[model samples]
Target: MTGVLAGALGLVVGLVIGTLGGGGGVLAVPALVYALGQDARTATTGSIVIVGIISAAGVLARLRGRTIDWRTGVGFGVVGVPTAWAGSLVNRAVPQPVLLLSFAALTLLIAVLMLVRGSSSARRTDGAGPSPGTPDGGSGVPAAGGGTSGATAVLEAPTRRRATVRRVAKIAGAGSVVGFLTGFLGVGGGFLVVPALTMLMGLSMPAAIGTSLLVLTFNSISSMGARIGHLDLDWAVIGPFAAVAVLGALGGKLVADRMSGAALNRAFAGLLVAVGLFVGVQSLLAL
Candidate 1:
């Protein structure tokens, strides 16, 4: 009964990850371990399945709205896929306490980024470049230099060679980090994805959110592959959890569209900070 209850709790975890990004999977591991009393390895495997399903649902929702930026998403996806698998392998090797501690700290860090608002951390441009999305940041727009209005346009051509290289490098670097985290932690990489897109790629909030979903999808698949040989592939666990997660993800997408962006960001940041504190305490306690 307790195990079933814990599995039910997994639905809530999936919903949060689907909606917010930072704390969902991070908390899911603990929920599976402590709430359900599963071994860390089993819990980690469970988290991967849950995160993947929720992320795919979110991507589907985003795609329906025509919000996904395929080019940027694919670019990030290419780098993240293999790394996510590697991360899953790492998760198998690491001690549970260490994983929890690292996850907690990451959650807190993302929360801070959420509060800062992507624009504040963005590389300064004197508002000269074309905006990446809607004039108000709601409408998905074309790549700045793509000379088209469609959201699918390739990323804007960098004005300076140095800047272009730097931007590409940043995207690749962020993708790698996000991939590893996803595989290792069973997260969808939303905490890092949104800020990285907004701050580094100059994408608007809507675009970033949409793009992150795609990146998450690719990362999940890659990581799942890593678990294939070592773990039990439990369809029994995946079925109910995925159904609830998909429903919750759909609801979250609606909420995301309705909420005030600034307020949401602030709330998310605070949440991250709280999660981080929890992780730090868990790590210390482990010692």
Candidate 2:
């Protein structure tokens, strides 16, 4: 009965990871603790293992589509490694209730952010004006007045350079935060990664999803490695869970391809809200 339950939960986690490019850890950790009878800390360790493997499988599933931005994903992952280790150290010191409460709060925060972003994107889509950065409002044609003056062109060059620098800095900062969360919570940090990649880095939905999986894979592995000596896994439960999740991930990828990005974002945000509320309520009652 426990084995069957684990498999069912694992499939759900994988589908979320594959379809949304995140949320697996958010689901996995809670399921491990509440359903499978694992302690909070052990559940986190197990979550890292499950999410990391599923993320790798997700990456492979998207490989043929060329939706991933390898350079960005690898750079983000590299920035996160040190912080992930640091977070693991902190994780060991925090009490279980505090950790779970923090996780619940963070999940709620991310859901709010996603909803805000989705609404903003919808507004932009409805507007008639060109996209913010485009000159002719996304018409692919130059403005009717022709090119800018020589002085304007000269100024724009430096502005573009500055923008690039700022973008790189933002990526590094976001990556560090994600890494820390991954280690501290035993989550893949995909809930945060997908938004960061799309909003900050300007990747399209498919690209962001694919790239998020790659980042999750890195964060999960890094966190898991830091917990190596302390980990006490129940392979009997995790083994079948992980195997079923891989198959679910493959199915999720197909579903994502057929859905609109806006719809996916809204759906993902709703799920987060529901889970966050449940987790938060349960934690408060326990306290």
Candidate 3:
């Protein structure tokens, strides 16, 4: 009975992870603990295995689409390794209830981020910005004489240097935060990774999703590896659950091509809010 329940739930979770990435896998923790009768700590460990394997399928589904940006994805993932380990250490010091409340709060935060991202996307599309034909840096005109003067090049060099530094900082900061959450909560961090890749790293939505899956795969490994000896996962349960989810994820990735990302984001945000509210209420009552 438990196996049947777990396999059923894992399929749904994998579909979400394959279709949406990021925060989608966060649902696994709650499902594992509340629906499947796993302990909170064990659930986190299992989430890594499930989400990671499913994300691998998502990555493969995206392979021929040219949706991935390898350099940015790998760089972001590399920065997260140590932080995820640190987050796992922190996780052990916290009580189960408090950890759960923290997870609920994180869910709420992700929902808010989704709405804000949607709004921001709309604004970017309609805002008073440069026309598509505008010159470099959105300047009103092309460079002098259709080329830059040596003096102009010298002047712009420092500006470009500053821009590069800022870009690095943005990437590093986003990766660190996502990495910590990955380790601390055993989630793949796809919710945070998609937006960060799109907004911070200038990837398109499809590209971001693909790249985000790769980064999430790294995060899952980091999180699960940190818990290697600390947690004992039930292979009988995890095996069937992960295998089913892998198939579901592949199917979801196929269907994702026909779906609207905005619609998906809105629907996901609503679900997160509902789940967060329920968890918040339950935790408070228990306390």
Candidate 4:
């Protein structure tokens, strides 16, 4: 019965994240701990397993339609995976309430960020800021290459090399920080990734969501590896919960393509603030 309920909840959480491209594992860990009665350590471990499986499923599905910016994803994963393992190890050492309180604070911070960033996203015009066509620091749209089409000899080469490199650096840095948090906190870190990808890396909303899921897969594996010997193994919890999360991820991916970006951003911001306030208050009460 407990497993069944957890799986059902996992499905709902997974669906929200996978479709919306956020919130799946953010909600999953708490559900596993508070509602399912798993220890904080076990819940963190289980979250890694569950998030990895579900994210992999989402990535595979997304691959059918769009080319995953693999170069960026792989680059970020390189630093992210190892850091994720380190994060898991750190989580094992922290006290439960402290970890929860930290989680609450981080979530709240993400909420405020989303609200601010989302508002900015709305007011901005296509060519208003430094984007693909503005100055070097802005979007950086380069001139056409030497080769021309038909009668002329000019190749259409935008400033891909420098732009790609810069984007990759930002993505990798974000991945590393997220991995560290995941290893330390035992949460999926999607909330952080979405905002980071958007505000820092400057990816499209859908791209950020998809890219974050890919990062989550690698991060989960790393965190799980770190937890292997340090803590008690509980396949009984990890297995079924992960299976359900995979289903939810598929649903989230579908929704991401359809939902209004503004609406999603606002809704997620509200959720973050509420969750943050609740956790912050909870932490104070326990002290």
Q: Name the top TM-score candidate.
A: 2
lDDT of 4 by residue, 42-136 (tens): 77777777777887888888887652556556666678888887777778778988888898889988888888888776777543554454555
Candidate 2 stretches greater than 4 Å from native: 130-153
lDDT of 3 by residue, 1-287 (tens): 87887788878887877776655566788888888788778888888888888887888888787878888888888999889888888887878898789888988887888789888888888876666777453765445787756777788889999999987898789999999988887777887788687667877666777888899888888887788779779877888888888888877776666777777667667767887887778778878
lDDT of 2 by residue, 158-234 (tens): 99999989978988999999999999998888988988898889898888899999999999889988998998999
Please, what is the whole-model Cα lDDT of each candidate in the order they appear?
0.71, 0.90, 0.80, 0.74
Q: Which stretches in model 1 have alpha-carbon errors above 4 Å?
A: 2-8, 117-163, 233-238
**Residue 247 local lDDT, model 3:** 82
| Ten residues in sequence with the least summed lDDT for candidate 4 | 147-156
Per residue, candidate 1 scores C-alpha lDDT tens digits across 101-149 of: 7778788766666565545644344454545754655546545587674
Which number leads on lDDT?
2
Give the TM-score of each candidate.
0.78, 0.93, 0.90, 0.83
Q: What is the lDDT of candidate 4?
A: 0.74
Q: State the displacement of the C-alpha of residue 144, model 4, in Å, after optimal TM-score superposition.
A: 8.5
